[model samples]
Target: MHLFIRATDAGAPPYLYAGPMTYRGHEGERPMRILWDLAHPLPADVFHYAKVNTG
Candidate 1:
């Protein structure tokens, strides 16, 4: 399935296209974390921003 991602909603940032992804697996019950394998890699800037902001 296709994936879209944005860093925040403060200014209603437009979602960046993360390309298609494949279901990888998941864990946990309460939160139900899910994993996906991206079909294509994200750009350097987008990857860095997402990583830093998300963590």
Candidate 2:
């Protein structure tokens, strides 16, 4: 399956879906459970993003 993610680190690449995950509370609140698929990075450069001069 294909996926996308807003990666913070440029070196770290995205990956495929693994399993479910849960977020624990800090002090005394109920834990939050979130189920989602992981993102996978593409091998090729799909879009050529560059700064353009519109002067």
Leading candidate by TM-score: 1
Instruction: Report the lDDT tens digits of candidate 1 across residue range 1-55.
Output: 9989876757766788889999999999999999999999999988988888879
Give all candidates' CA lDDT scores: 0.88, 0.35
lDDT of 1: 0.88
Residue 29 local lDDT, model 2: 38
> Could you give candidate 2's per-residue lDDT for residues 9-55 as a string of tens digits?
46755533333433433443366443433343333332121112112
lDDT of 1 at 45: 85
In candidate 1 the C-alpha lDDT for residue 53 amounts to 88
Relative to the true structure, candidate 1 reaches a TM of 0.81
Which whole-number lDDT from 0 to 100 does residue 52 have in model 2?
22
Off by over 4 Å in 2: 1-29, 41-55
Q: Quote the positional error of residue 27 for candidate 1 in Å.
A: 0.4
